[model samples]
Target: MHASITAAGQAGPRLPPVRNLRATTTQAPVSQTVVLEWEAPEPGLAMDHYVVYGAALSDFSPSQATLKVRVPWTTHLHSGLPADGRTWHYRVVGVDAAGRVSRFRGSTQVSVTTASRGLPRIPAGNLVATATSAQQPDYAAEFVLDGDPATFWHSQYDPRVPMPHALTVDMGEVRPVTALTYLPRQDGEHGGTVTAYAVALSTDGSTFTPATTGHWWALDTEGTFATWPATRARYVRLEVLAGYRGHASAAEIGLFEPPA
Candidate 1:
């Protein structure tokens, strides 16, 4: 039969060569100081260091025996960690150079929690405005004190003096603030020229009523800085008139829950 088909095509049956490990995590429910990534295995064939393991998802396991880290490859950040909520399990191992170890099993499972305090106390006074010559570094102003004389209100700004620079907080009674958070201050000198801001809600703080008159918002940028969402009124006033060229700073001010 043609010499047995050329000896079975020169004895074709030597299949055994497949190696490509992987471990990735760029985004997920993860948020605690997360940053674990990897992908390396194809060059000179001498990998001899790289092992990272994690546990806390109700006892996750992969043979249960991995926590080594020793390679030329790097990308790790598992800092602090302890919001008390758990869901963490990562893996990456590839030891060569004689130790002979290759394992890359991380199907993705990161859900570490803690980071949502949003509105608790926030009600001290209101004095986050600096600009002695503002060179940079000064931002802290936030207030929502409802004493209901009519609905007290105050929003400060200092471009050297006058546009809207007032600060007050008494909160005697009116109770109805839904949201307010401001913390802008890196130094002074208009601190990066503050930039777009407004929040006015009164029930008796000082004869005021203009809860966002047309569409003005800029809490300083980072994540949810100015949110009235519905407007209930109790005395919440934060006004930086405009910033980001000079003078505008805040440190703390948050008030929430009061819409219906």
Candidate 2:
């Protein structure tokens, strides 16, 4: 039963922009993709959505001509971008139901450079995969290369296998390998997503040399790229050193050749 009228020309409260925005890039077969992630401001307030802007310049203004997309979530993937070794700039701002937009600040912007053209994806059918353990029928090792993110390869659960699971793939012939792509299970649960890993290469499958080793983002759901100096090998091995919940799983795995 009580309402107060505001004075004319007085500005209303505006939503605060997101914080700690960061970008991650993954090199696909023909193109490069960037994933934008940010943390919502503390004491979350309701907003209609966020507008993402992209341009060739970092200090460019945000307007209709540079606007790229409107999303309701805190993460977005910019895909199908040409791998021309050009840097791309991005900015995001929060918009409320009243059409009032948050202040455009430099802290909310990020930049990523697309890699040069790379070799086409190696044929999945040409790969022969084997794993240390598999859930069987439902979550088998072969599923990782099926080209479907909907399915995944999970370690044995009935016996409850522990971490340090390994997956080996034979390319059927020796070829130059420049990178490895790992796509975490996208079904929403982070139970078995890999956290730390190591990759090895082998020509006779009996002797392998460690190629690269690193840790993936905690609970990362997007594709993670691991690159190293080009090496020729017929067999590739992935060793999972740690997982989110003491388990290991992957939706898809791919190998890439050097840029041609």
Candidate 3:
């Protein structure tokens, strides 16, 4: 009548939360883009993936309502967010194969503010663009002012030019420029997307003065805005300090004028 000895089942190893979670946001043309990055936890059982949660409220809890994405890597780019000048909060958690999830708490949360969607873009008909280099007849500099978001200006690739690529546009005449919008390549390709940049204005196309400098979120598919005090310049230059995949490209570059 005695029962055979039974072996107890062991539980899977506990996984720890990610560390050094960081975030950055970019105010894009149609939305706010957020880039989140973090370091993996101490070596342990492999994780199936990581879940990203986001909300407009700082005290929001991580749940199905706030779930943003599930990724297998340490970095993620969340786009198409509302650009209503509100602070966005984000959290990340790890999940194992057995559906075990890491703890969700304040330690892994980060936040960023979305900027207002600025003025409308003016016509680019009267502008002419030139670049430091070009790939060929296919991706020349003139495409940036052609009013076509499908075509773009790509830097030289045959010889494999280095970074710091420059694209200059003559607005036909010196007009009061309040802001500039840079539309990234729209073909879903990540290469040649500007990350760090500096904008300068020149009245004579030779003498230039720095207007503003900043960084755009990497792999952002929407347009980026750079504002400066109303400056009169015939030429505007977009200097690519750094770009994704060590290349530079732009679909369109347009300027904004003060409200009439």
- Report the number of the highest-TM-score candidate: 2
Worst 10 residues of 1 by lDDT: 143-152
Per-residue lDDT value at 130 in model 2: 89
Q: Which stretches of candidate 3 lie over 4 Å from their true place?
A: 1-120
Candidate 2 TM-score to native: 0.62
TM-score, every prediction: 0.24, 0.62, 0.57
- Each prediction's Cα lDDT score? 0.40, 0.75, 0.75
Which tens-of-lDDT digit does each residue in 176-234 have in candidate 2?
98777777776656777888999999999999999999998655654576777889999
lDDT of 1 at 82: 28
Q: List the candidates ranked by TM-score, beginning with the highest.
A: 2, 3, 1
Better of 1 and 3 by lDDT: 3
User: Once model 1 is optimally superposed onto the true structure by TM-score, how far is the C-alpha of residue 154 displaced, in angstroms?
Assistant: 15
All models, RMSD in angstroms: 18.9, 11.5, 12.7
